[model samples]
Each structure stands twice: as C-alpha cells, then as structure tokens.
Target: MNLPDTFHLIGGDALKTGTGGSLEHVNPATGESSTLELAGADEVDAAVAAAREAFGVWSGLAPMARRYLLQQLARRINESAADLSALSTYESGMPVVYAAQMAAVGPAEWFDYYAGWADKLNGEVIGAWDFNYTVPEPYGVVAAIVPFNGPVWEIGMKAAPALAAGNTVVIKPPELAPYSSILFGRLCLEAGIPPGVVNVVLSGPDGTGALVSHPDVDKISFTGSAGTARKILAAAAANLTPVVLELGGKSGVLICDDADVDSAVGAVAQFAIAQNAGQICTSPNRVLAQLGVYDEVVEKLAAVAGGFVVGDPLSESTQVGPVISVASADRIVGMVGEGVSAGTARVVTGGSRLDGPGAFVAPTVLADVATDSRLAGEEIFGPVATVSRVADDDEAVAVANGVDAGLAAYVFSRDISRCHTLAKRLRSGSVSINGLGNHMIYSPFGGKGASGYGREGGRAGIEEFLSVKSVSAQL
Candidate 1:
C-alpha cells in the first residue's frame, strides 16, 4: 500500500507539528509500527478557513455541477478499491475479503446515492396563503469526524451528504486508521472537487477539539464512542453548532422459535460476529433466542463460530482476523473470561486468544449470559457475542430493550405480524425483519437513547447539513 509520511490535505496543507506526542500507527495484523506528523491548532485553523472560503463557491454552483463531481469521485473510489481495502486490513485489522466490500467499494455506492440527491432537492411552497416557500440552505462548513473501524464508509457517509447539500467539509480521521482517509483527500482533488471543498486534519483528540470548537465551523458530524461524543458536545456547545452523532451500540439479535434456523445462525455467526472483528456499532452481539429455538441456535451458532480460524487478515482463506489492537483483544477476552469465571456466563465456543502473533481474539459465543452483566449490556467491539434464552417474544423484546443501546436489532421469524409487533415494542433505531430491508444504501441509519442521535443515510442524512429558510412576501 502506498503510504504518505506526512498528511497534506488539499486546500490546506496540514503537515505540521501538533501538541507533541507519539503519532505511531501500528499494524494490528503484525507488530510493526510507523509514524505520521500530527496536525496542530494551526492546521485546524487553516483547514476551517479554507472550508469557509470554499463554501460560498461550492454552494453557489449549479446543483448538477456538484452532482457531476460527486459522481466522478464515486468512479475514482471504485477504481481504487483494491488499494483502499489493503489499507483497511493493514491499519484497522479489517479482513481483506470484507474490507473490499465495506471499507472500499461501499463508499462508491454512498457517493452515487448522494450524488443523485444533489439536483433533486426542492423547496416547498405554501399555496394556502401568501406565496411563501421554505428553501433548504447548506450549512457553511461541516466538520466530519470519522472513526477507525470503517474509515472510507463513514467518510463517504458524512462527506457525501454534506457536499451534496452544497456544504464544504474539514474531516478529522481517527488516529489509528488514518491512511485510507488521507488518501481520500487526494482522491477528491483528482476527481475535480476543488481544493478547500474537502480537507483532512490528522491529529489526536487535542487537534479534534480545536476543529470542533472553532467558531467558523457550522456543523459537526461524528461517529465514535458516547464518551467522546460528550467531549465533542461540550466543545460544540461553546459555538452552539449543530451536530449529527452516531455512537456505540450493543445491538440485539432476536431469533424467534419459528424462524429459519440456519439463516438466523449464519447471519449472526458468519456475518455479524465475524465481520470487521465486530468493531462496528451494529455488531448484533447481544443475541436473545426464544426458548424453543434457544438450544438449537446455541449449538449451531457454536459450531459456526468455532469453524472460523483466527489468523492473518491478509490471507484470503482466513475467516477471522486480528482486531484493531492488542488492547482491544485483551479487553474482549477479559470480558468473556471474567464473566465465565464469575458464573455469569458459559463459553459455547472459542473464547481465548490464539498462541500466535497479531491481535487475534478467537470468535467467542457465550451462552446463558446474565442480561444485566457487562458481556450482555456493554458494547464489546470485538468478535464476541452473548446469548440468552427468552421465554417468549415479549420476553425477547424486554431482554433486548433492557440494554442502554438502541442502535439496531435483528428479528428472525416467519410470522410477519409477530415480527412487526416485536419490532414495534423493541426500542431500537432500526429493526431488521428476517435481516432485510434495513440499514442499507437508502436506509436512514442511526440510533436512539444511548446509541446517539441523527441519521446518516439517504435524504435524512443530506438534510442534516442544511438549514431551512422560510421566505414570504406580502402580496
């Protein structure tokens, strides 16, 4: 993978010294590490200023022109999928197979999806009274803070909509996995997105704080932990800037008695548990199975989970790979081991680290986990899941809603009415019936309660970067 020693964003060249510290990035698949220069307050100010300067010009453009440029970026993203996928595996420990679909090619879909929205936006005229209309205007400068788990995907999620709405952006990438995002900045310029329309600042929390707190920044959209969101909220409060946040989740996977057994197990064990080392917010790790299917689901899920071998992420045949870092692996292992030792849960399959290099945590499925325990309630951003038995659909909904998070829930059942009923009762942002028609390219993805607020897909997402101006004239 081609890596840059210093991060220089397009309009605002950001190769500068930050409040000094180690900017070393470690490859989770190996122990090797490299360093990049951090952006300080100066870089933040420059990037913000550039974004502010460019916003008027970008917003003033004919909508079709913006659409054409966004589509060009989409084409570039598709062309560069392979290199970006490798970066995801190297930097975030995302397995290469899934990285291609998610961290790489997936962004192309986002750009295309939002690109179409650029020219389609329309204002409403209130014909009941005087000729009054509401015009949707883009917020000036949007600050997009993306997480390490899925850099390109979230970058596309945040930036595409902002740009579609005619807003300029300054992005702050996670310190651990900044490679793909840094490359993305160059892609913008190559795709004919004018300089200052998209800028990236490389820094830790200090530099991020500088960008979030900047007076000129009009909007902030972040995807990370709730704790970090609190700090960002505090900073944005000083400027009273509106923010769109997508935070952590301990999403539930509900398998009803009448559901297709193999399909449910496969979605949970094969996709949700194994993908990205379960680093995504919608991991669907807190599994609640109805009593009739609980034992069978547990047995089948164990076999499927155990079948995956933890190894190098670069290997094509490897099903499971290392997590983002050794620290995360250790935490996930401890969460399971401690729960099992405390008699709160029982391990159904692999639960310990492999005796090899890399930050490998074997795929784990813990059965009979206490609903109130950490393994069930907390967000374990690793390849670990906790299963519990529910007496009925009501109990399943209750147990699923018991957690503080409400990002997503997976419900499996042949009975459509029962599925809708449970989906209604379950407190989640989006409910997937039989694992379809939800959280997709056009779905509005977000969470409620502790999962944070604001949607990140489709038209709702683009509206996040826009403000409404009511225009009326006396006739």
Candidate 2:
C-alpha cells in the first residue's frame, strides 16, 4: 500500500509540508521502512482553525442531517474495510484478519451506532419554573489524541461520538501508525462531511501539545498511557478545557474453584495476551486463581501460549504478531526478566523473544506470581500473563483489586449470584462476568483510579462532548 507523500489533513486537504520534523513510518511485520512525513505545529494550527470554523456550520445543521451524514460515513468506512485493514496490519503489526474485524468493521459499526443518537438528544423540563429546561449542548471544537495500538478504531471511537453530539474534531493520530487515520480523513470528505468537521493532523508530541493548548479547543479526549494523560491534563488546564482520558490498565481476571477453567484459560490466551499482540489497554495482565484449580489453569494457559504462531501479521494463519517495535519487545522482555530475577514469578513457557525479522516476543506465561510484585501491579502491554494463586473467593477478589490501575476486571464463576457479588466489589470502570470483552458500542467504557478518568462508548460517550445548561423564565 502506497501512502500519499504527505499525510497531514487540514480543512479537508492533505498538506504536503509540515513545520515539525519528519517521522519515519516503519512496517513492523517486516522491519522495513514504509513512508515518512512531517506533522508539526503549523499543521495543528491550521486543522484547529478549520475545525473551529466548521463547528458553526456543523453544529447549526439539523440533527437529522447530521445523522444522515454520519450514516453515510459509516457506509463508506465499511466499503473501505479491506484496504484499511490491510494498511493497518502493515503499519501497526496487528494480524490482518483481526485488524479487519476490530480496526475496520468494529469502528464502522460504532459510527452507525452513534448515528442513531444524533436526533435523539433531548432536553429535560423542570417543574420549578414557568418554563425551565436543561439542555445538552455541544462543546464546539474537540481535540482527540489517539494511541498507536489501534489507530483506526480509536479514530472512530472518538470522532463518532463527538460528531454525533454536533461537535467538530481535530484528531492527532499516533506518529508510529498514522496511515489509516489520514485515509479516514479523506473518507470523511467523500462521505459528504463538511470540511473541518473531521480533520486529521499526523504529528508527534509537539503537535499534540499545540492542539491541547489551543484556546479555541473546547474539549479534549485522549487515549494512551497515564503519564501522557497527565501532560495533556496540564496543557488543557491553561484554558480550563474539559478533558476525558482513557489510560493504562493492569486489568485482572479472577477464576474461582467452581468456574469454567477451560473457558477462562481460553479467554486469557485469546483476549489477554494474544489479541493485538497484547497492546490493548484492558488486556488481562494479571490472573488470580483459586488454589483448588490454580495448577490446572496455569498448565492450560501455558499450553495455549506455547501454541501461538508468531509470524508476519499479513498472514491469515498467524495468531500472534510483532510488538509495535523492537524497543517495545525489549521492554516486555525486561519486565519478564525482572519478575524472574526478583523470585516473584517463574516462567512456565515462552519467556524469550522469537528469532525473526519482525519485533516478535514469545507468548509468555508466568506462574507463582506474587500479588504485590511489579508484574502483578504494573501494566505490561505485551503478550504476557502472570498467574497468582488465591485461597478462596474472598482472597481472589482481594488479589484482583490489589493493583492501582482499575480499568477492567474479569470474573469466572458458574453461579450467577457469585459473579454479580464479585463484580460489585471490584472497583473498576468495567467488570466482565464469565468473559473477556472490553467495550461495546452501546455500553460506556473507561477506567478508575490511576487508570484515568472519564468514560467513552454509548450515550455516555457522546455526552462527553456535551455540556449541560439549565435555563429558567418567570411565569
């Protein structure tokens, strides 16, 4: 796939030059250079200005018109799924089939889901006054800083709700993998979305800083590490702009003695450490199993890890692909080594990196993980799962909630009542019972504690781009 010589989009036009220095785009599957472009401060300013101008027209449009345009955008995205998925695989190192399902089709579905809400946003009448009502109004211009792991999906995840709420957006795609985002900008134009309504700026930290700090930017929505969220919060504070963050997670899964051990193991293998090469924020990094079934669970998890095919992401049969870069693989391996050296955990299988051209790390499983250790508390965004044994349900819950990051938690129990009880006790933004799914288009998704604040997805997701105002008049 050949990308345009320039990738930055401003006012619906791809800019051929940027003030910021150029960034080299690497194809992780083959460890080869793909494309290069400069995304800098000047481009960010132009995009933000265009979004501010377009906000007046977009927000003034009839809600039905907005809905129709969004539906069309979804259709265009669906039609482009194959090309987008292939480009995403090349840029982000995700398996082609998974990319098509999650990065392309999943995002298209979200646009359709949010499109249904465009005309449904309503105000509430209050009884205190002759004519009083509370209205939900768009924040005008929104800035979305998306992560590299799932660039295409994150773009739709942020832009769909913002647009549905009548807000225009300026997006800063991650520098590492930005082709799909730039392509999406063109697709928006083709779908009849007005210029500036959906602008894409492909810059690194400098451009991101400019967007967040721009006075005209009414709101900010960011998805990535907690440390970066802190920086964005600080920048947004200058203008007192409202911000929503979806940050890191050391998400855990609790397996009770009476749980479906086989299903739980399969979930850990498939969702926790294998999907997207474990680059997901809500991947199950920690596993707390009841002692009665701990050994069996560990063995099964090890077998599944050993079976993963680490190869080219473009291959249909490959299950696990390379991490985004070699540096990322090294970081993951370093963490595993730290766990082993501290005697907090022992490698069950696949502790080392695979011998290949791409940045591949073996799907690793660590047993006897200490509940208080770094492996248990830290977010290891890699294909590794650490298992810790617990004595009972109470201890399992305690161990699961021990970490500071509380984005998601999973529980596996045969008894429905037991699962519900455990789910309530877990202090997380999302808790899954008997499975390992993160977000749905109709449900709110976010994190608590150090995992960061605010919610995304569903009605709550669109509401993030809106501000409430109550008006009253004397009878």
What C-alpha lDDT do the candidate models reach, one value each? Answer: 0.87, 0.88
Badly placed stretches (over 4 Å) of model 1 are: 10-21
Model 1 agreement with the true structure over 296-410: per-residue lDDT tens digits: 9899999999888678888888888888888888988988888999899999887898787778888988999988888888898888878998888878888899988899998
Which consecutive 10 residues in model 1 have the weakest lDDT in total? 12-21
* Candidate 2 deviant stretches above 4 angstroms: none
lDDT of 2 by residue, 110-144 (tens): 89989999999999999884889999999999998
Number of residue pairs clashing in candidate 2, backbone atoms closer than 3 angstroms, sequence gap of 3 or more or interchain: 0
lDDT of 1 at 450: 89
In model 1, residue pairs whose N, Cα or C atoms come closer than 3 Å (at least 3 residues apart or on different chains), thus clashing, are: none
Worst 10 residues of 2 by lDDT: 34-43
Q: Candidate 2 has what TM-score?
A: 0.98
Steric collisions counted per model: 0, 0
